[model samples]
Target: MENKNIEVKDENGNDDLYEHFRFLADKGQQPLRVDKYLMNRVENATRNKIQKAAKDGNIHINDVAVKSSYKVKPHDVITVLFEHPPYELLLTPENLPIDIVYEDDDVLVVNKEPGMVVHPGHGNYSGTLINALAYHFENLPNPAIINGVNNTNRPGLVHRIDKDTSGLLVVAKTDIAMTHLAKQFFNKTTEREYVALVWGAMEETEGTIEGHIGRHPKNRLQNTVYLNEDDLHKGKPAVTHYKILEKLGYVTLVSCRLETGRTHQIRVHMKHIGHTLFNDARYGGDAILKGTTFTKYKQFVDNCFKILPRQALHARTLGFIHPTTNEFMKFESPIPKDIQQCIEKWQKYSTHAEQ
Candidate 1:
């Protein structure tokens, strides 16, 4: 990786620029709506700027300034001129040890530990899987498909796991593998299983939750499903099937499978069914772990107002077809130490009632 210094001006003030843009158009095609096209291109750019740039003739479609609504064709040279923002600290490869469960020329699987973020974002900029992968593979493939013109720093990442949720993740080492794996994910052909520790024993041994998930209307940062049918935002359809594995008094250990992957799908669905994961403060598990000794020693617990630092969810098993080899592969990760300890502690304290 290389470092460069640049400057950009935003609403706040003059800031360093650290953004890149790539255009995808073919010759003889009408230009794409500049603002509409750019909305998909730049992740951090403001809509106003993107629109203004197009209106001001700063964007060229096939070397010609066009209206924002101009249609674009393939192979057309689309050029966007914008100020780059300052480079911020992002996930950089480090020598942090990782448990590699499976690896081949096209793909690699690793047992991700809890507390380790899959990628870097707000408030977290280092020690991520991306950083570790960069250090581990000298010539690692860039997994990100440059969609339209978006430029993100993440590379070799096919899927993601939350920072606090530990699990097994597959990384694509080649473009063919990346494409094939992404298709499986998009088509929901891949099989994924998770183990979660939730508060309260399940009344039923097995059940399925189906709902639409979107950002919570009242809470900007949280995701929720609307009870009302007339809400404008139609949440994407998400399904999760769960079976209780064991009961420890009030808490229950369960395994879940996803029919669709949406942001915070499992967590939100579990909470919706009145069984929030143990120690999950967001939905309503805060009271469950109150005064529990498990929080005394864990740094994550100490730092938060709540006990659990991350959601008690783990991606336990993943099975998919090999994109390159055409072979079916399945990978599984055991529960991480922290989650295991939490389960044990709960079992020790809670007197097992009749299951």
Candidate 2:
């Protein structure tokens, strides 16, 4: 049987479906940087965007992660993974309701819901944030257009969060706003904080995880943090600052601040340190990683999964300089109801364990 939705395992591992683009270089193809080669084949793709994808280990040649600078050879099979679907010229605007946290002429902050794909892709052609935005703003301009081509679907998207990870995200309304905001993200000046429930207690109250994050060598479906310095180019520099907010017997609630935004940075880095987010099935957190073997305990976890079907992660806060006014701006999102209920259940379980 074919899996209709492209399921991408989260770093900690809840199965979030994603779209992927695959290509094969013709035998007569000339050697060129992978990024440059991709721009021609990928609709509406810019060199910068392609390079960023390569740096994040989303670009592959014959199943091995490659850098943007890597030259593509004739008959070399290539693939690029996206959290969202590849750009198709036809982007139908759908009238989906969006939770607008704040909006102005220049920018808007949206509180994205869990299981909502940020943009439209292969299997998911409608009901995305982009589709909603296109309907809301009838004339929004595409941010990363190149060579007189524009991505009609992804207009105003400066950055993106995962499909299953609910959180706050900022969108640009104009070309100037998009350029300025994209620069902020590229320079690592933007601030993002996430709150997550992981399946273990931390030895330290607060610490930083620094590693190179890229695609898993074997598993093209997921990202992994490279530990060796020699393989740094294969991945990008990623830093996450975490503080334990609460200890719930077998699971811990953590506040994570991202210094550098790489794909799946927080989830993968947390798992790298042995603290996969609770119910993150991809990274082995879905099972009882640190809990008791008792049937009751197993039943309790199963119940939690029912309440929150995906990984326990959320984008709680976002801070950046206003593109128009250059003033500092920040926004926050409350924990979604499902995660709150899951945490409450853990709290009650911890209380009972103490007795």
Cα TM-score per model: 0.70, 0.76
Expressed as tens digits, the lDDT of each residue in 23-137 for candidate 2 is: 6665545678888777755545678999999898788787777999999987787877656544444578889889999999999999999889897765667779998898888
| Whole-model lDDT values for every prediction | 0.69, 0.81
Alpha carbon deviation, residue 20, candidate 1 (Å): 9.1
Over 4 Å off in model 2, which ranges? 1-87, 145-152
The reply for model 1, stretches above 4 Å from the true place, is 1-83, 86-91, 143-151, 232-234, 289-309, 352-355
Task: Give the per-residue lDDT digits (tens) of candidate 1, residues 77-192.
Answer: 55654454323224457999989999889899988887887866545568888778878986655533432213245666777887778898998888788778878988899999
State in Å the error of residue 152, model 2. 5.8
Residue 337 local lDDT, model 2: 97
